[model samples]
Target: MFIESFLILLALNFLSAGGVNRPEERIVGGGPIEIEQAPWQVSFQIRGHHICGGSIYNADTIITAAHCFFLSGAWQDPRHYEIRAGSKSIKSNGILVKVAAVKVHEYYVHKENQFFVLQNDIAVVRLSERLQFTNKVQPIPLAESNPEPGTMSFATGWGNMYGADAGDANKIPIHLQGVKLRIQSPNFCVRFHGQSKICAGDSKHTICTHDSGGPLVINRQLVGVTSGRGPNCDRPATFSSVPYHREWILNAVKSFPQHV
Candidate 1:
């Protein structure tokens, strides 16, 4: 829950983008990243196509943005999605795990007044089987405590870079990319994302289309989940505050019966 002292607004344009900026590409003003740089990073896919990015929360669970399914009008049935981990390429080699269940925040609902705002944009995905942990496949710890404003962090993903053809599957990046970003003040985020969300980077350096559901990490801890981006992938991007939903995540994972 957000502190009572804070209040907010919706940068309607950002939410109305309608999942166009998924796999929001490479960190703007950043360069190509190594395949194993962020081992916990995973690609959320439909069939064999990459739709969004997510973080490996544990051996059999993934944490990603809820809007990844809702905003894109994707089927929520576990059979319709897959997790490709331990690799950067969308089509080549990796451990492809079938999804068993997708637990979206119960309170996460889309509002339809003027802005189609999807609040509480987080979800937990349970894999059908436990994943093999390796140098290239591992889980990242969620941030136990929130970091201060202006803290440096990195966001890595295989989304579109430079907004080229943005949502075009053919134009999305195959190799992952990473860029350095700085956490923004709550006030800065309120201008674009509203409460319970945070902003990272600035006009010159920000996450873009196709990168939603990716992790924003600081000190190797998962701090944020990529939520939405400004139009054209430029300007500051909003993310679901990981620390804010930590308790819900723990309970969600604990309630799921382990699968063999």
Candidate 2:
């Protein structure tokens, strides 16, 4: 009885220490992701502080979770965000691009439930200038079709391994991280929001704080965008389904101004 009580207390402490469904979460049981392993991975920041991970979809366009811009309040100004590409380390060298515009999904909504529920949690960021692709930088193609449930996928981010506190310096990792996770059934995550979200991984291969806005790729194609995740990072990580909103993304990218 005493041991069970201690365990319950420990769980409660963890929840209190790391808030649930943080804005930007990371891989909990993943290893270091090398600089060139995922060239399309980009660090989304505000004033040089890494807040979330994003993907380079084209020479001038990025895709991330809408919650990154819409959570806590209404959408924020694009000028307040910066995109850093070609860097494995958030603090290392990379091409910093000023945001030209922000395009969030029209139906996105945040709910204040026991779960940090997000619906249609997807967005795009247009760069002020075209990024020069190098050995360390490139664009990833979006999945034309959704990966079937149970398919294995890969996710990358710069979030913490220990928990969600950016102030906890010791838990923060400098190098980017990646984890292999299996895609869970849309029905499995339906309770959180609906079929628009994909739940992947479990408690071990979970997304923790600072990894939000990252991409879930299968066979080099982005199939999902990291959105809300559980307090423990181990709860099946929820992501915005990319395939479901592919049309919107393409239209948004096409409508945005392109720099020559």
Candidate 3:
């Protein structure tokens, strides 16, 4: 079992008036990436600043970590900022939308219940306006169709350079932090039986930190949102399991609720 701690907030990039600031594009394992993928990759902003990477699904919603919302002492209400999806650079203009509302899993308990991100650390944000789909800015597929296990997956976010905490105070270009992890034994899932969750990353490499609330994508579909460390962030191996609360995810996304 892994230990739990405070759900910390780390900033990657903040949205600027021009758009977001991003870095160069890199692919994981030399796999092919769609040229239009930039359109769907998103960056979360608090009060129009403090960037956290995300991805768009439908015309009206984005999926990211609830911890970004949970740990922040800032952010009071959903406001109009920018949802830059297509641009490689966070500063580049892509799809800009206002944050209409947020619908985080109701049972999501951060600091207290560390092992399990109760209600699953998933969150949905409704945009102020519908986003225009472009070659680079379209929604990635969802895992609800059949969240793949033990498949090639990709993750992207702007957290840190290394040896750091989760939430930083800067936003670089929307970069891809790609690594290859497999869905290990559901029975092998540690700490309160991460049976409902999928374990990724090798025990010696490619773990998570500020990448929480990011995407655990497989076959171009979103299977899980970056939850947090099972025990600690530096454990070399971390788990980003899908929540068993499918009803909450599906039901809310089906109707599209509001969160801030």
Candidate 4:
């Protein structure tokens, strides 16, 4: 019972703070990520502050972590949301895309010991407009296959620094901070209470704070969504595995009304 037993305990211990998934790993060398002509990433505003990470899949849709605002009994309306596409600078990104709809997993439990850790953690946000691909902003290629262990990748966000002085202060990247880490599995990571659906950080350097909802990039293809920091971003990155949620993403795309 991965979700029922192991996941339950982890949710109780870590998710008690009310955010996305977490863990640690070794970072690929190069200090911080060097800016290249890469695809556009997305960020969301929660409670007047940006705490969520996401990526543009199409002109009208963005993918993010479901836990962004999914707390039992107190979740806020997902309307009035925003997404920044082109630029890497969190404060000065190019396009500020407005959201038209927010779709979360219907079976999401937000509970302990659930069998579906990969199900409810994924979400889709429909944008009110379509985007023209640009040098600094473009859609990342979707996952073509599940990442095998030891596959190296990058995760980016403006969520928070592992040691944030004040909440949301360490968030919102002054500059895009990207770290390289390899993917591990629940085989041994779950011993420390991780899920099988996530790629464990190599326990080297932590993923940066502002990286939630950001993309777990591998070989230039989008692999995972930065769901949560593993109590420390300097460790390995924990993610909501995109490979395991392909059908869910397709359904969300299909279920979206096109009237807008």
TM-score-superior candidate, 2 or 4: 2
Candidate 1 lDDT over residue span 1-260, tens digit each: 14211110111122235433232444576777765789999988765766678999899999998877663343345566788998877777879998888889999865544433557889999999899998888899998776688898899887667663453555467888888988887667424554477778887778876677899999889999987665566767778888888999999999899875
Tell me the number of clashing residue pairs for each predicted model.
Answer: 13, 10, 30, 29
Worst 10 residues of 3 by lDDT: 15-24
Colliding pairs, model 2: 24-209, 24-210, 25-208, 25-209, 25-210, 25-211, 25-212, 26-208, 202-234, 203-234
- Best prediction by lDDT: 2
Off by over 4 Å in 4: 1-37, 46-48, 71-73, 112-119, 162-172, 190-196
The global C-alpha lDDT for each of the candidates, from Candidate 1 onward, is 0.73, 0.78, 0.51, 0.58
Which candidate, 2 or 4, would have the higher lDDT against the true structure? 2
What is the per-residue lDDT of model 2 for residues 104-219, given as tens digits with 9 covering 90 to 100? 89898777656455788899889888999998898999887777878999999987798766556566678899999898876664355455777888778877777888999999
- Winning model by TM-score: 2
Runs with alpha carbons beyond 4 Å of true place in candidate 1: 1-26, 71-75, 112-116, 164-171, 190-195
Candidate 2: deviation at residue 169, Å? 2.1
Ranking 1 against 3 by lDDT, winner: 1
- Model 2 global lDDT (CA atoms, 0 to 1): 0.78
Compared with the true structure, what per-residue lDDT tens digits does model 4 show for residues 30-141?
2444234346566665323444668888778888877664533235455545776676565665777677888887765454342113334678888888877777667776
Measured by TM-score, how close is model 2 to the native structure?
0.88
